[model samples]
Target: MNGGTSTTTATPNPSTTAPSAPKTSKPGRTSPPNSNSPPATATAPSSASTPTPPTASARSGGRTEHAVSPRLPHGASYTLLALGAALAAAALSFTALAAQFDNNVYDWLFRVHPAGHRPHEAVLLAFDDRTLMDHGGVRGLRRTLASTLEILAAAPPRVTAVDLTLADPGDPAEDARLAAAMLRLPGLALAAEMLPDSSGWQDPRPEFLAAAEAIGHVHALPGPLDEINRMIALERAAGRDRRFALALEAHRLALGGGAIVSTPSDLESGGVRIPSRQDAGRPLRVHYRPSSTVETLPIGALLADPARARALRGRVVFIGVTALSAIPDRLFTPLSPLDGNRPMAGVEIHAQSFETITNRSFIVDAPPIIPVALAFALAAALAAAFTFTSAPVAYSLGLVLLVAAHTLPWLAFLGRLVLPPFAPVAASWSALAACAAFRFFYVRRQLASSEQTTARYQQAFHFVAHEMRTPLTAIQGSSEIISRYNLPEDKRKQMGQMINAESKRLAQMITTFLDVERLSAGQMDLRSSSFPVSGLLDACLRRAQPLADRKHISLEATAADDLAATADRELLEYALYNLLTNAIKYSPEHTTVRVSATRDAHHHLLAVTDQGMGMTPEEVKNLGRKFYRTERAERAGIQGTGIGLSIVRQIVDLHGGRLSVESAPDQGSTFTIALPA
Candidate 1:
């Protein structure tokens, strides 16, 4: 019965049995029978059984086998992402939306940190509601102005600037009286207006213009976004006809009427350098004096007493309408109430402009590059913080950066610099958010990878305990029988043969496991060679035949003798053997597992078809994932660790091949490996 069984087991073909044994030693002496020795000792004599050496191309390729180069370290990648977000936000600072936001911040800084100790060089003589009503309203504006000027002449101011436009002919008698009264003042600057269409200036009447020493435009330049009067254009021109601002004209006359010197970036007049960039419309950021420090004498009150005229003696007097209902020249200011209930009058705004020039309290805007550079520096610092420090330290540093972004503007404002808060604030916030989110997700991914690795190790432990225990027990039992029992020579030789076989099996199992792990990690180099596909299939079938016979399953293979493949032959054999054994293990008794090979013009295809409990499409899709098993297989209590197919897929992929599966519920399954020709 034993001889007949041996004949049946070896009946597949002589070629299969010949390749299964080591070429260098006799079949019985291929490995040592002593299980007490290390596994390496059993494998050492079977050098001819080892896989071929790696091809020259694979050796030269080394670590470059991957199509893509390794990525930058996590710190570098995170820094770049954060910096990109910050740069995007900084670029947004120059847009109109950020400008609008900056305007509000500017106003906030102004209110929080007001100027100290103004020069008090200008006074307001207002045409208040009481004065206008007492002087017969708007129709009597010229008469009221004439009467007020006559009183001011008693103690003439150093320079008197009117914030009114007398561009058209009024009542002739009243105009004559106004001209006569204006001539009594020592120094006079008359206010002209830009036409509504912006085509030209509306100069005062010829008679009145001749009476004034200097003529200036009364155009208050408000912010285009909010219409808030934050700045005043120092110089305005229309078709070769240029006019200084009313406040500039008044200041020039007050300081002995010096000629205004101009430059692209600044204006110098009255021995004062104004930081007003001509390309930016010569904008002079007005440092408005506190309202309480401004002295105002209502025209009606001045006329009633006339003693208040002495208060205007050494100061420039800005005379204009202050009645909110009478004139529509009211506008907002940085110092205006937040609710917008109080808007400064245009005349008062001009007076404040004059005070700004006199006090040399100009708020200069920071250069365009300042904010951009700050954004970059802040982003870099944040990147470094996260990279080198712990979480609490990094987050605390991030909070400090945020505070710096807001506080820097205030400090600069105190130094008379108008630093827009938008850019730095936006950069800090965007970089913080981006880095924080990246770190959050990166940590999550790392944690998930760690958990997966732990689970995989646990599964590997199960595989070792389940698959290797049988061979180990057989080897240990046979070794003990040889060491302790006094048996006949033939019986001892049989036990020794069994121990040797199980040792070789255990060694091969360990080698295959290690090879799969190394290959999956991209650390193994493949030994490429060309071989006949039929011979490879025969070898794999011979190895899996014993397992198939135990379950009463049949192994069937079909391939042409001329069929060939170029790949790692040992790995391919191992993959095919795994597939065949899995098929036998999962299939019902009396079923057949088919192994076939074919070739097309560009590729060789190897397929294994099994008559077993089939898988659903979802199960098929997830088949080769490590530790993944179908519900049916688990329910049937199949003895598997679910890692065999994963190892097979890894081996095929390393050789530039693809493994594909096709199946449906309650039907047989087909696994195909397509290798490059």
Candidate 2:
């Protein structure tokens, strides 16, 4: 009983609502309320209240008014941002390149804090040419050294390191004399050299070794890339025996020669874990004293000035060759205060290394992952910056990130940490630029689409004005005739009839305009029901008959009365009426506009064929565009806004149907609407 009531109510509702539905939908699809005018093929005016976002219609490589404009999906924007970040992250993983920039930064820092300005406790007693000349050159070096050792024993210094490879044997008597002198001083140390291939060692003579308090290797390895001596290995292998570097050994002896903790990769003195080169070898970064900080005097000068010799008491003294002509032993270093091109003597380098270890001053290099992680962080920041901000703001953020890149590393360097500065800065700016460019192009395309839409609206407005002018003039002229003259009853009645017809024509055009707008916005709800095709065709013929009679064109329908269609009857009637009217309007007198309905395999086809001035291939191709008009129609003074076919197509699409036209110049045209049965 409830279902019967619901069905009965629904049946009446559609019929009662059918006429009123066109009041809103068709008016929006055709024209507005105040517009009771004919449309020269006019289209619906866009709603002022509803804003349309700009979008691209097609990617034609060139702009065309007919192409659709649609907004870019958010997914594509996100994908571009991710792509930029991934590329940046990939580039940052090359640690070697980043490390090179770090090395350069360190060089600059060393320049700012040059060596030799600060006072150093350790002193250099170099065996220069002056000492050599006094002792008769190399031949008398052993005797001179033996004499110096005896003087050092009389007024013993805290510690004395002989930074020389005393591997070569000398006269037995001279060796014995040097050995006796060395035994007198309990704080004496001798230097040894490791073989280049780490196979063996060049130790001091057996007599000298027996006398010395400690022995350590004097070999220093330069940096792998720049070949500058910036660090020193704490331990080196000599055959099966491990040898400490000269600096480590000297520091140990200075600390009262305690039991040293040593390993292949690390060393410890006084409970201090020695900071050394990581991964490659156990090389420790040297904390250098200024070249002038360690006061140097020739051995002859120290021997000549007894008072000066007394000042060396309780000081750690390193004795090595400094004269270029004699030993010529010097190498460039990062900590070179005076000249980059000139080398600091080898002995000075060893002295600085010893100072570094004894003072526990070390530089810490961040782990390899630090740079890679920072690179990703910077990339993500740039991505977010672009995402949240406009192009100009994002660019400003990029500048800030660039500054941070260099600043952070510099601060870390000051804190005794080695952080790479190159990759993070480069990646941040690159990612920013890529995202910015994508955004710029996207905005440009959107603006172009908006402009095209505006142009379309402007054309639609003009079309409405042009279309309404004709009927408005006719209505005014006919109304004036009926009012001004006292004509015969039949003549006045005829003039009055003309006014009513013109008014109705104007009203229908407005309705058609509004219908298009509503349908396009998907606001038109179809009142679907099964109805005979003949009924729809009969209504269209009745409406188009007046226009057909004016043109003296024949209007015929060949649809079977029982051939039915399931669709919005009123909307379909409006569509068919438009086709019939257009055919009558464009065709010459005595032409026939045939309306027919036939069923095929899957669809019932509603076709309107005319033998009028047909369109060419190009005109047919562009027939469905809003506000389009053919040049042939224009020449023949035919009235149309060119949007009739556009409305027809939209109506067909709403019904899940298709509309197609076949035409050629001078051959007339056929328009078919295929609706599923």
Q: Pick the lDDT winner.
A: 1
**Model 1 vs. true fold: TM:** 0.81
Provide the lowest-lDDT 10-residue window in model 1.
38-47
Q: Which stretches of candidate 1 lie over 4 Å from their true place?
A: 1-80, 338-340, 387-390, 466-510, 525-535, 538-566, 580-594, 609-622, 627-641, 661-670
Q: Candidate 1: lDDT of 473?
A: 61
Q: What residue runs in model 2 are displaced by over 4 Å at the alpha carbon?
A: 1-97, 115-119, 129-140, 262-267, 277-280, 325-329, 335-340, 464-612, 616-626, 643-663, 668-677
Per-model TM values vs. the true structure:
0.81, 0.70
Clash count, predicted structure 1: 0
lDDT of 2 at 147: 84
lDDT of each: 0.79, 0.71
Q: Write the per-residue lDDT of candidate 2 for residues 60-122, one digit (tens) a residue.
A: 233222323336544356346745664665575465665566677787877775543444667
Query: 482-547 in candidate 1: lDDT tens per residue?
Result: 565566687677667766766776666566566556656776557688898878887877767765
Q: List the residue pairs that clash in candidate 1.
A: none
